[model samples]
Target: MGAARAGNGSDGIATNLPEADDYCLTARDIRCVVLDIEGTTTPIPFVTDVLFPYARSNVRAYLVDTYRTRQTMDDVAFLRAQIDKDLADGVPSAVLVPPPSAPEEEVIDALVANVEAMIDADRKLPALKQLQGRIWRLGFDGGEIQGVVYDDVAEALARWHGTGTVRSYIYSSGSREAQRLIFGNTEAHGDLRRYLSAFFDTSVGGKREPRSYYEIWQTLGVDSPSQILFLTDVYQEATAARDAGFEVLISIRPGNAPLPEDHGFQTITSFAQISV
Candidate 1:
């Protein structure tokens, strides 16, 4: 997700849009709406500020507290594999995770180092994302964190769900669990998960890869890729979805990174702009 200014309850429409009124999903025969989280439905700062920091500060405690659990063991194994690959590739800041027989403190230290490096680099590896999701689940469940989304998101989701003609899905680099935690515990609308049909993560593929969008189309069970509309703040992701034959819209939320002048995709600043 790219950065832009926060929304201020206006229509939030972008100026000089290619075709002012051409953003209607109904006009394009769209049936599914796949949304991006950060910098799209939710503000980028919420993730960069509240979520990332929460995960970073609590990772060590989370690991230590859950150290002996089967899930943490599984997470460790997954991280070890990724870190091994990273080490072989001479990834900067890559550290060796000790064998499971090693002292627990030593293992946790190595894992924490590697996890911090991955988080600092904003790497979208599934292992890092999955672990972060588990950490965040604790924060969300403990009332230490509340998900933040654009003001218009809940109403738009409700409108689409009410129609029964459109399905809303989330596609993010964040893990599926993280996606659920945010939408399920939003500040504006508690339990927005009811509005969403499914969640997708990097397991399908990288967000920038066209094949990922192809896989999403197949999983959506739509008649054609054209029936799916994807919204994102990243130019590359929009291009990827468009390349895969899905209708694409670039979200112009506050704090979103600037798009290329020639990006050539239609843009929307609020979900209300989408007439589903």
Candidate 2:
């Protein structure tokens, strides 16, 4: 995750949540809507079942072939730093430490093994996400993978964007390039990227961090947090966006984690139910 930035609410007026039925931004005041990917826009299964396995199976070959590239080298360097930090913290793993002069194949094998372990554990480490995204790109371009989003998403995005009232954006842990690829090459929606104005990822800040939402608000050049509405399936993510002063709604998508019975946020099962 990127470093957090401190800021005030001076850019936009803050507002409290309205009545339950008034949660729709079209009924209230909103200028921009930020969305999460996995559960909010795309079905969780497409990610856990399709994307994860593909990355886990292809990491070795992808890394071996791409390691010399500047971007891949940067990701590897970040992974090495993470491994070093784990070692300093006394975590033990043969894959975590290898001599700098180790054979290229041996190093790649260890890295692949370690990365596969991280995927199994569902670690959100940026380096791992970067590598997986790169691998997925190859899969996407090879016709081996096709992105999936909920049924209501494509139409809602087009409708919302066509109105010229609310600009749409994506803020996921996936890299910006990966974000574009999914929206651009979706199986159901041909080139949905046209509906989106921008994309953001961990390069902003951790999704669950309040500062991240604020940074998004700032980055989008929006007037106030109240003018932005964020949608996510995770209650914690909703809480973070709410705390950051943006209006937030919990997306109750199929296969999404169940929201708590006492969850305070307003919830929606489809984008058709959302406005603005």
Candidate 3:
């Protein structure tokens, strides 16, 4: 929802998958692993059901309050550009900027209004990602929301990092600050941030694009994609990572994943079983 499926691997690699292996990294071949949030570590519902909506509800307020800030002005540019593109396609401003609150369609209507303007202005941007991230920050800090990590994640990550050889990271559409907030606020062993080394978001070309992973590799100064293990619940995302040469792991867990008959990769249920 942020940009990519929450499975880039981990804080170390860049995904959160439903399944992992018992013989992959094994505390030797690799020094770092990237993990994803969402379905990989934190359950999808926490993100979708709570984080997304909370941010959605607060975006309007953020826009109004921050509209004068340099960042919000950037969002205006973002919205203008989106508007221009839609207009070029024969759309009209009437649909672009509807009345402030159109009942059940207020939120979406606002988005359309801003997006149309963005396309019109020719600005491909990250205003929304930024705004949502900021709003979510307050919610997280307020204790209005709680991040959920799978039951098995705590011990596995603890053991993996406890080896003192492996490093972990986080990559998600969420902002770097949001990543810290979630991990730091997680129900499992509060403040997991110390275990993580870095954070990434859609600014990295997004997960669907192969270049994001490449950028990650460059940031890590890692030798090769093959040296890092990319984990996720979405096969399409794993495919992009695999294409980039990062070792791939799939996560399959109850209520989190839809079973695939021919995934063509290793699957895992918990971090406790992961190996390298």
Candidate 4:
């Protein structure tokens, strides 16, 4: 199905769809490359199937076992931070939860329900991400979870970093720690963690927000945002990167990607399609 089938569709031309000829990188422009996990460098299921389920099955227990404990309060605080951050970033309140028309109790209930639902969806909801960070922390400590990155990731990282072609990093809604765990424990990758320079998560800013991309550039000591090529499967995020002045490429894995939209950036079917 084309993007039109998604219901919230846009004409392909309205978004910038680049031809292969338009893209040129002779392993010179990109001094640093930041990656988005699902749909980009790795499969969506690796995160949704492996990471999400690990966190979900453990969140309640982790909460119950730790409720009122320092960590629980910290998780709540992190979620609250995400909420306030979104509001400050101009994400409409309605998208998360419209202010209740009813009493205070109803509003509180709606808020909790909204957060929980986002959690269930493995969404990037601030609350869910905070909880994911916490759950993964526990899982990692207990040896119940090992982060799962893709087979291609290690080879790609080695090639990029070994040749001094570009520095590699990750940006995901998953906690920075979770991102590290996944990449660090790729079944064959060994500890590829040393190859990365930094990781950013929702705690920094929503992925769809241009400011987050700006922050990433700032962290990398790259004053020019356009100097970096950000690979992501999500068009909104790629839009955010391009809006922030970074180069953008959308990766479409099989059974992944929501049709194709330049979404104000370039699009690719795989990392192999990208020319460093």
Candidate 5:
């Protein structure tokens, strides 16, 4: 299923399915390669089955145990602000009871419950990402969480960054710190963070929105969005990048969801299949 499906390539030309060479654009003109995390640079199971579960199972204990620490307080404060916003917007969500006057432990308990619920629901809230990133830092530091980046990813990153002309970046819903933790603690290539030039997260904008791609392009200091090749497994992401004028490719990796046959974006089975 990792093989590319039959579809129209990004160039608006139809070709034999999975013809890697045909999708390989001229490398000389490409200036940056922005990658998605799950299913693109890393396997989906590693995230859905491993990291997320780890975060979810440990969140309550981690939060309650570290409630007094400055880092924990900062995250709690952010979550509180988000909750306030949700309440103001009339969104139904768990809230810290007896606002502004609740005992510290009680407030922490409520926040922990809300955060855990967000994790279970798989909501991409910034506060949740921050809390998870902090927890994952501990796991990574203790050797309990070794990130699982795909074998081809390290090589492709090296090749792209080897040239002073082309740079490599990561743009995922994961927080920048979470992105750093994974790349910095990968099982293969042992800290491939050196190969990455920068990281972007949902903080830039929603992945499905074209404006997010534009913000990424502007942040990369590139004038032409065409100089950047955005690789992701999700069709919506590919469409967003294409709309933003960045070259796009649908990554077909083991454990990734099947792409629609009629999806017009070009597809590649391995990073090695991509030239730049």
Candidate 6:
């Protein structure tokens, strides 16, 4: 599938549906590119199938092994605070984290239970993502996990970086550390981090919220929102970026969730289609 004309007649939005031609970006004065990870640069299956499972299955051992370390203690404290709020707000599957004085096994068990639940629910809380990033760090360092990206990603990143005008960034729900770990350890590319200028996560704001894009635009220090191009696989995200005045493109990738029929956004199957 190529670019699908968005039905919504927003001013400056592309409305031409090209059957065979890829959506061209050369016409736009895009100075910065903000990319989404899951379902856009990386396959959804790599996250849902491999990454999540690795974190879920190894969380217990990780907690047990690192229990007394300062980092683990901080992680536990953060999760405890989050779970306390969740329980107060009546969030389902929110488990009680035992106190630090509790038996080590008991504390580890409670933390693991809550972590697994968060993983299953795919919660975007900073506590959860921070812990997951640390866990994945071990796996990546040990050569147990290798980051996976679309074949077109590394080349496009290189091309954009080579231009000296278009800067590339990643804005994902994944913590910035996790984003680095993924891009820094890819098998085929072998350290794509050099091409990325910076990373943004939930600390900025939720991806679907327009204000998040506004925050990113300000941080990028670009001439205008129109100077940035946001690529994502979800319609809501594309809409959010567009509302923030950034040009948007919806990525069409295998195993990605279906978009609404009337979701009026240009779509691209490969980053190679995008010209800086």
lDDT of 3 at 226: 78
Deviation (Å) of 68 in candidate 3: 2.4
Best by lDDT: 1
Residue-level error in angstroms, candidate 1, position 155 = 1.1
| lDDT of candidate 2 over 82-121, digit per residue (tens) | 7777668775552664665888888787788788888888
| Cα deviation of 212, candidate 6, in Å | 0.9
Q: Superposing all C-alpha atoms, what RMSD in Å does each candidate have to the true structure?
A: 4.1, 8.6, 8.2, 7.1, 4.5, 4.6
> What TM-score quantifies how close candidate 5 is to the native fold?
0.88
Model 3 scores a TM of 0.76
| Per-candidate clashes, comma-separated | 11, 1, 64, 0, 0, 1
Record all residue pairs in model 6 with backbone atoms less than 3 Å apart, i.e. clashing. Answer: 6-264
Please give the RMSD of candidate 5 to the true structure.
4.5
Range of the 10 consecutive residues with the lowest summed lDDT in candidate 4: 1-10
If both were scored by TM-score, which would come out higher, candidate 1 or candidate 6?
1
In candidate 6, what are the lDDT values of residues 1-276, reduced to their tens digit? 454454422233334533324645567888899999998999898999999999999999899899899999899899999999999999889888778888999988888888999999998999999999999999999999999988899999999888888899999999999999999999788999999999999999999999999999999998899989999988899999999999988887776776777566767778888865
What is the lDDT, from 0 to 100, of the residue 253 in candidate 5? 71
Residue 118 lDDT (model 5)? 75
4 against 5, candidate with superior TM-score: 5
Q: Would you estimate the TM-scores of all the predictions?
A: 0.93, 0.89, 0.76, 0.74, 0.88, 0.92
- Show pairs that collide, candidate 5: none
Global lDDT of each candidate: 0.89, 0.81, 0.68, 0.67, 0.82, 0.88
Ranking by lDDT: 1, 6, 5, 2, 3, 4
In angstroms, the error of model 5 at 141 is 0.6
